[model samples]
Target: MMEAPCKRRRGDDDEDAGDRDRLNALPDSLLREVMSHMKARQVVQTCVLARRWRNLWRSMPCLDVDQDEFTTAGVSVVYSDHEGWERFEDFMDTLLCPGNVSIALLDTLRLHASSMGEDRRASRWIRRGIKYPHAGQEPGLQRGAPSCSSWRLRRLHLSNLYLCNLLAEHVRSRCPSLEDLELESCTCEFPAIASRSLKNLVLKRCALKGFREITSPPTEEPVYQWWL
Candidate 1:
């Protein structure tokens, strides 16, 4: 005689149904906000969850593309395998492409790589995304300053990188919406940085030799936090 069909557990069925229903009920904006806090890879993986999530990442307002995320699950960043580096590059190229993300609403971008400047591919990809439209010539970011800028960039955080002397000028002239700037363990060559829109400046363990001061709005001095 054939065995009776196994019955599904009521609790398990309800729990699964509730999860799907709750996720599906959330508005796109709220979902996108939730996605902002997740890793770039995880965010992209959500596309396979359902039809509604297929294109949500394309308009995500904030993106954190950290190279550390590409490493092996339990490996330290220092001993990361190079195998995932190429994948990381490919992911960045696809994500940064003009049609991939809504550049108009992109206000925050945090790129964390162990040696970003040394890796030409990483720099090129960054330039490509930062350029947004033009993709031919190598911009000044490689040489010194970033020639291309985004009008919507409000917060910029640089860590363990060499910043150029013209960075201040570029921000003042190009990045009109910039408000927060943070540099950690970075080598800055700029003597002074002045921006009418900058509201917060934080420097931690940065090497400041000739660097003199930061010029910001007089109504209220930009909150300055420095750690030697």
Candidate 2:
């Protein structure tokens, strides 16, 4: 007896079903190595992709954002879009946390939000993002005065965030693990950054009138320091 010939599936028929699932997923470490090549803006856009690729961004652990990218995301302070304000909040809610977070999770979060001072709250959050790039599921975290958490921060990038003695002091007291800190283009300054582990530090264009160094309890030396 002759049997009927078997038929192969069409390319579109097979592909339409679903993307081939990876049986043996690549190790997170290796996968991050590949994500390192992408810029922060590109990483943010990947959220719309499949869930597997959703969190693949935070794995970079190092976030780099330029001025233009900030503007495009509607995070620029110099510009204003009544509608963008609402959209920005919605956008932030989605980027709360990237599960694969680590201490060095976000080494640099360069936020170039302009110096717009109309809405204090929105400006503050923009500044916080640059200082801390770790993503989470929760949003609406407050900053300014006591924003410093017990977490270890490797680098902080802040611009145009006005601060008072209370906020400045809070960071100096809380960020125990901060290694590199930048207060560029902001009009605020910490009371004093007394961290012995601080290697690279910058305080530029800020009202650091009260900024100082904690020398009375000072013991070790700072690898790198700067004030401008």
Candidate 3:
């Protein structure tokens, strides 16, 4: 072999294959934790890293979506174009669909939309966040109230959105696990907000021109408090 100048074997001194996959080798929980600190777009982009990470972001315990991530233009332009809004909605649906979310671990959902056009889309996304899929339920069912039996939502933050009385009522009645709710610069005509599990409510710069009152749970602990 020496006389013939033998060729070096490819693996003669190679590092372990696993060494090159350090990030992928991390535990799924740790990986998710890392992804949690990133925006929804960044989290979704990790799918391209490797086959193992393709669906890892789907199980993220927290979701943070902001319209500003897509564009810097005014809300009017962002929502006026049919194709632009459609793409935005589609992207959100893909990320926030009930099937993609990990219900048991989901704790925080933050949706921020700057314009009225995105309000409805934000509302629909919020509903899907708390929605539970029932057995035999048709896939992609767009009608009817969202099932909240499996809701584990604890913290929600909505900004620059329009909400109806029914949506507020549903959140108060259906999401028993909800503890903190923050509505910033929102437009709502709700008469009242009543939640037994709510602890901290923040209404900063919210337009409650049609509001009537804010009622807390019957508990004497005064666990619920509102901040304006």
C-alpha RMSD values across all candidates: 7.1, 9.4, 8.0
lDDT per residue for candidate 1 within 1-228, as digits (tens), equals 999998888799899999999989999889988998998889999999989988778767677777777765655554355666766767777776655653334567666666544453454554444445323222331212233454466887766656666556666766777888887777777789888889899898888868997788889677889999
lDDT of 3 at 146: 36
lDDT of 2 by residue, 49-138 (tens): 667767666445555543334444544443564454445445444444344333223444554445345235545554453355444312
Report the C-alpha displacement of residue 226, candidate 2, in angstroms.
4.7
| Tens digits of lDDT, candidate 3, 1-228 | 348778877785465554656765789889988888888888889889788988777767678877667764555675565555566677777765545654334677787876666676567655554454232133553323235364557888889888778667766766777788889888877888877788787887887867876666767243433455
For TM-score, the strongest prediction is 1
TM-score of every candidate relative to the true structure: 0.76, 0.59, 0.72
Residue 145 lDDT, candidate 3, scale 0-100: 27
Go through the candidates in order and give each one's C-alpha lDDT: 0.69, 0.52, 0.68
Find the 10 residues in a row with the least total lDDT in model 3.
134-143
lDDT of 2: 0.52
RMSD of 2: 9.4
Name every residue pair that clashes in candidate 3. none
